[model samples]
Target: MTDFRSRCIAPEPLAGLFCAIPHPTGVEICAATGPDFLCLDGEHAPIDRERAEEMIRAAQLHRVPVIMRVPGHLPDSIAGALDSGADGVLVPRVSTADEARAAVAATRYPPVGVRGVGPGRAAGFGYRIPDYLATANSRILLAIQAETPGALENIEEISTVEGVDVIFIGPGDLGVTLGALGPEGRPKLMAAITRITKVSRAAGKAVGMFCASPDEVQGWRELGITFFLIGNDARHLADAAGAAVARAREGF
Candidate 1:
């Protein structure tokens, strides 16, 4: 398995595309597209554990890291993704330091955290249990979403939590919180994003965010965001298909 956590903290920037289609083939295609990692969306997408594991396997085959955005900051939610062989779990709606710590603990085993032992795919189906256990705590990456006003207020404290690797900003939800969206709200959203990135960097943590376009990615990159989850598979497909149809209608 790729040591995604190590790559995340490396000096170079890490870029990843999101997958919301819940299919291994889509994940494989994204991995082949050559991003540093791929984030499987379980929070907004209808991906179950089985499908998530399949996607992880696909990404692994391509030697690309896969991080799942689990639905919430719950033990089962976080563990399900890790146990499914995901390189890490991105817990959404993490609004406080305690919530961030809980998300981190869920990804680890006892003493360090409360994750239970299981001979699942992550352990190579019992064959690599000893090896897996020996390094799982440190190997597994943990990220929490800083998407709401509450999360923004406690961003510093959350970033300081031990075991937390990334602090991802959810711009859409954040815009909602700030009562700003679209072009009119871009300034406020950008300000919040900059603040989150600065705070996370100050705490020695990686900053991550979602970007739908190259322009957005460039903008965030300039602000010192090394970890990026770009456009999802579904949107990419739809956009391509729509463009293709439009070209055909234009008769070359």
Candidate 2:
């Protein structure tokens, strides 16, 4: 599997899709299609650790790295995702450098941060604890969301936070927060995204964001942001299914 962090920082853009179906089969299907990575959504989906672990195992079977978008910044949430053997953790709503630091702290171990050691799946069930501990702090990618106005104001500081591999912009929530939804608000939202990308690049951090359509990829890439999560499992399924049904109805 390509290292998630390396993929994020590489010059070529990393393309990924969010797997929100909360099932191993769903993840397997997406992985088989081959993306640079897969983000299993724990924030909006009903996925628990067991399910996330199962999904991770499924994706790794295809040698696809997985980043778990944990529901919150709490230690336990981050720990659960990492323990499930997620390639990284994406913490949402991280508005300040302090919150970013806290998120990274929970992700690293001991002297580096506060994460307690555990012989979880990522450690090969206690068999590879030493190796896992020796490398995890560096191997695991730490991505924090910049979705609020506060995050926009503090983008420079947050981007400079150590161990924060990717500064992901949650355009949807941010649009809502900035009242930058729809046509009128899109310019405002894009402006915020542009600012985040600019500051993050200056700080040598990878920038990521959610794109509603594939067409937006190249445009965003021009902004020096590489990581992108465009579309999701549910949307793909629904679109294909609907298209098929529409075709069948036309025949009828």
lDDT of 1 at 207: 89
Q: Assess every candidate by TM-score.
A: 0.96, 0.97
- How high is the CA lDDT of each candidate model? 0.87, 0.91
Candidate 2 global lDDT: 0.91
For residue 252, model 1's alpha carbon misses the true position, in angstroms, by: 7.1
**What lDDT tens digits, residue by residue, belong to model 1 across residues 128-194?**
9899999999888887889999888998898899999888888888999888798989888888988
Candidate 1 segments exceeding 4 Å error: none
For model 2, residues 1-252, the per-residue Cα lDDT tens digits are 656677676545889999999899999999999899999999999999888889999999999999999998889999989998999999999999999999989999989899988889999999999999998998899889999999999998999899899999999899999899999888898899899999999999989989878898888888888899989999999999999999999988
**Best-fitting candidate, measured by TM-score?**
2
The TM-score obtained by model 2 is 0.97
Task: Give me the runs in candidate 2 sitting further than 4 Å from their true place.
Answer: none
Each candidate: RMSD to true structure?
Answer: 1.3, 1.0
